[model samples]
Target: MVERQEQAASDAVMTRIGQSVMLHHAGDREEARGRLLDLWTEIGEDGDPLHRCTLAHYMADTQDDPADELAWDLRALSAAEELTADRPAGHEDASAARALYPSLHLNLAADYAKLGRREAARTHLRRARTAAAALDTDTYGAGIRTAIRRLETRLGENDPDDPRSGPPRQRS
Candidate 1:
């Protein structure tokens, strides 16, 4: 069926995205971005949401500009939202599509934080937490939760009223 063929193509794109992520992790950031950009050109902005989500999510990490990073992360989030809306439960791609949401939101929070958008960062962080709750406590879920905790700590440190920001200053 057409759906199965589409799934196959989407899965191939995800595999390529994974390879690009590996390249980025291996310190070939620009090369990784180049590969992803090629994939994006092939997939187009309105292509399979699963492919777009995976590509954009990893693409954000390769960006040198905070604003560009935020843009890619936002794209990933948008694709994820579309995937959730379009994928029906029990559909072949539904589980795989749904699994991207928590990390997509988490990346958005990080991107917003990088751009000093505190309120936006906090909002996306909360969304990430909510999405994470639906994930089973496997390796992926644990990693997402850890990233959320780390980002929360970083955000709290910048807030003067946060108890975890450290003890109050002693009188001079």
Candidate 2:
């Protein structure tokens, strides 16, 4: 059936993305980026939303340029939005896609912070926190929470009105 074929295709794309992520972990960012780019071209922008989300998420990490990273993160977020809109409530795919929003928004916040877009970073950080409420505080969720806290501290330090400001405090 058409649905089965789509699921298979989506699985294949995720496998490829996993391989590229391994390549990235092995420190061959350029090769990983190349592999992701090839996959992106194959998937196209309008491809399966999950495929787009996974690819864009990894592709963002592979970018050397902060601007490019932000662009890919945006793509991931956009694809997640599309996935959310397309799926009916209580569908497994819908739940899976919803699970990605926190990480996607977190990455976007980091990217914006790197680009010196404080307001944008704060906005995405807030969204990430809101999305994270649906997640249990397991290892993955804990990691995201840690990252959120780190970014919050950093942002707070830059705010003159923050109690944590006005001191050259070292980050742990």
Candidate 3:
């Protein structure tokens, strides 16, 4: 009975999150951010790890500043780590958290790159690539892989030590 109740609560939270995501996609970013912030307050800092991870992941997207986005993404990654640590291997939640690692690392890589932390970005990019092997070959997975490749190419093009690489180009 307790398990069922917990599942119900999780489902409710996910539904609300989905609705907010839709609002974001529909161009009501401020409204969506407000809704997500409300949900975060409701969930609290020590809420269920899965819920926290999911919420923080989406919350990162709604941020206006890159630094804020990085902070939220870091929160999401921390929650995912907690979720994986709390669950047994092969548990559904553990598996789900593992699945999130690639994207989380990828986002971190991009954030680090934006901040001109090339070595940090490279480290996260490698982690992302290694974790990406777990991703399925679906459109979402393909998109991430493509983004990783693009970022790698861009990073390679901006080697500060290599004068031949030239000045950093503007991000598209």
Candidate 4:
């Protein structure tokens, strides 16, 4: 019964997060950010790790600044790590948090790239690729793989060690 109640609460939080995501998708970025901030305040720093991870992940997307986005993405990754560490091996929550690692790393990689931190971006990209091995061959998984490849190509083209690599180009 306690577990069930906790699950219900989790579901409620996810639902709210989903609503804010919808707002973001509709281009009401400021409103979405506000809503997510309110949720974060309600959840607090020591809230359920899963809730914190999910909220922070979405929060990163709504940030206008690259530094803020990186901070939120890092928060999401930290929460995911906490969730996996707190749960026993093979437990559902642990497994779920493990599944989040690829995307979290991928987002962090992109954030790093945007900040011109090529070394940090490469590190996270490698982590994302390794973590992606656990993903299923669905559209979501395929999309992530594609994004990873694209980022890899871009990074390769901008190799800092090569004098002919040229200046950094803005991503469309």
Candidates sorted by lDDT, descending order?
4, 3, 2, 1
The alpha-carbon lDDT assigned to residue 2 of candidate 1 equals: 100
- Model 4 residue pairs with clashes: none
TM-score of structure candidate 3: 0.87
Using lDDT as the measure, the top candidate is 4
The root-mean-square deviation over C-alpha atoms between each candidate and the true structure, in angstroms, is 4.4, 4.7, 5.5, 5.6
Q: Write the per-residue lDDT of candidate 3 for residues 1-172, one digit (tens) a residue.
A: 9999989989999999999999999999999999999999999999988888989999989999888988998999999999998889799988988988988998988888888898888888888878887799999788887787777787773434435446766766
- Winner on TM-score between 1 and 4 is 4
Q: Give per-residue CA lDDT, model 4, range 75-121, as digits (tens).
A: 99999999998889798878888988989999999999999999999
Runs of candidate 2 with Cα error greater than 4 angstroms are 157-172
User: How good is model 4 by TM-score?
Assistant: 0.88
List model 2 lDDT by residue over 48-112, tens digit each. 88889889998999998999999999999899888889989687777788988889998999999
Candidate 1 residue-wise lDDT, 1-172, digit = tens: 9999977876788889999999999999999999999999999988987788878888988999989998998898788778778878766556776787788888888888988898899888888878888998899899987788789788762333445546644434
lDDT for each of the candidates? 0.83, 0.86, 0.87, 0.90
Question: Which residues of candidate 1, in runs, are more than 4 Å off?
Answer: 1-7, 157-172
Model 4 has an lDDT value of: 0.90
The candidate, 1 or 4, that scores higher on lDDT is 4
lDDT for 30 (candidate 1):
90
